[model samples]
Target: MRIVIAEDAVLLRAGLVRLLTEAGHEVVADVDTAEGLLKAVEQHEPDFALVDVRLPPTFTDEGIRAAVLVRSQHPRIAVLVLSQYVEERYAAELIASRRDGLGYLLKDRVADVDQFLESVGTVGAGGTVLDPEVVSQLLVRSRHRQDLELLSPREHEVLGLMAQGLSNASIAANLFLTESSVEKHIRSVFTKLGLAHEDGGNRRVRAVLRYLGYPDPGPGHPSSAHPSHQEFRP
Candidate 1:
């Protein structure tokens, strides 16, 4: 897939370029600053962009701001953020009622190369991919939310995995439950949360956003089939 990368760390940026290049995907551009990333994406119009939370100059929210801008200006380009810190506020803003082709993975939490590649593919293919730590942090902050409190423990597990952008089958494998059981739990979540949308993917995104305190962007955008939770062991 065509791609652009934005990270200030030279070694890490080079490693990402080399890693992705060797894996047979083309790296159209790799830049050190958020401006460079935006320019590269606009110039190459890559299928997706892999960004860091921080970037040059300020080393603070530059990369994320660029990411949000890319989404706004070029809705077709998917985004995956890799950050050393959680940056909960930026995460929520980036999510902003959209889940597909979006990801937020903690840099230190990316334990395996293969898993990282899996997540890359997930976001590239328009699937959601949140780091489990990101999911936990987002959820913990919303535990007192009324809609969230309606979930059963099993439903909550399913909800978290769903927020992580796992397919029903993947969630089943992770939880050691049957796929049917996973579907049932997901259905219950929708019922309890009042997200009775016609599209399954829409409902999934809505549930995730509801817990995160964002509303669905609109109706009818299809959700992508999720990849396995590869960053950690089941």
Candidate 2:
């Protein structure tokens, strides 16, 4: 795979370059500033970009802004953003881009090299990948919302795993349930959240996250209005 890295810290940038290089992936461009990162993406058009959520020249949300721009402009290039904190707002914005090939992970997760690489691969392959910590924080922050309150305990478990980018098969394995059972739970989650079951891929995930109060800032995205709540008959 080809990758472009956008990180301001010298040592960490060097480490990422070495790691990706050693993993048999080519690092097409290594840049320090958000502007430079955008330029590199335009020039290289790498398969994936590893971006830090904060960048030089104010360091607030340059990286995230650049990531969203990439999704809007390039669309084909996958992005995995690294953040020092689990900023739910930033995560929501990135997901609001409503693109598949996106990931948000805490910088601390880099220590687990294997899992980090797995996340990279997953994003590169056009899948959404959210850090477990990010998912946990979002769950806690939105637990009081009525949409979330509508879910059963098991459905809540499945929704959390789904937000972590787990497929039905993986969620089933983790929950010690059959894949069919996991699918049923996921359907129940969508129905309770007032999201259409036919809305597969990232749209469904975004709807669920929006219902969780992350608030998709995407243009024309639906507001958090629930369909008439129906009892879970199973």
Candidate 3:
């Protein structure tokens, strides 16, 4: 895949560039600021962009805003943002606006080079991927928590695996279920979540996002930090 990387930390940026390049993916542009990210996207029109959630100047939501802009402007450019924390509202906002070819992963996930590359490929191929921590944190703030309560414990587990971009086979293996059983549980999740009309891979992602609170952020919702967010990050 051809890619652009926007990260403020010099060493991390360099490491990413080296890693992607060594893995035989093109690094079209590597920049440190959110504005630079936009400029790079407009210039290169790379297949995907790996961005940090925070970038130069304010270091708060810059990369995310730029990512949203890129998605709006060039709908074809896949974007996967790496974050230092499990940013709750912005993550949901980004996903709610455009779920396809999008992802939010904690930086530590990058340490698992093979899996990180797989995530890059997944998002670039127009799939959604969220780090497990992001899903867990987002669930705590779910505006539809009661809706989530409608799921059976098994269905809940299935949807959680779905949120992590796991396939039915993978989810089955993880949960020690047969693939057919996994599919049944997934369908139940969709029906209970009222995503029956959502359809195909889209519904699965939609259901996972909905169950995990990736909808429009409610104004009444607290903007305070979620306790789970603090527990996971290094």
Give the per-residue Cα lDDT of candidate 2 at 47: 95
Q: Which ten residues in a row have the lowest lDDT in candidate 1?
A: 224-233
Give all candidates' CA lDDT scores: 0.82, 0.82, 0.83
TM-score of each: 0.62, 0.62, 0.63
Per-residue lDDT tens digits for candidate 1, residues 1-234, read 999999889998898998888888999999999999988987999998999999989898999999999998998889999999788789988998478899999997455789999999989999999988778767755653777888999998888887776788899999999999998998888888776656555667667766555434444643222323222222
lDDT of 2 by residue, 32-80 (tens): 9999998998898899999999999999999999999998999889999
The residue ranges of model 1 lying beyond 4 angstroms of the native Cα positions read: 109-111, 145-234
Clashes of each: 0, 0, 0
Over all chains combined, what TM-score does candidate 3 have?
Answer: 0.63
Worst ten-residue run, lDDT, model 2? 225-234
* Model 2 ranges off by over 4 Å: 147-234
Error of 2 at 148 (Å): 11
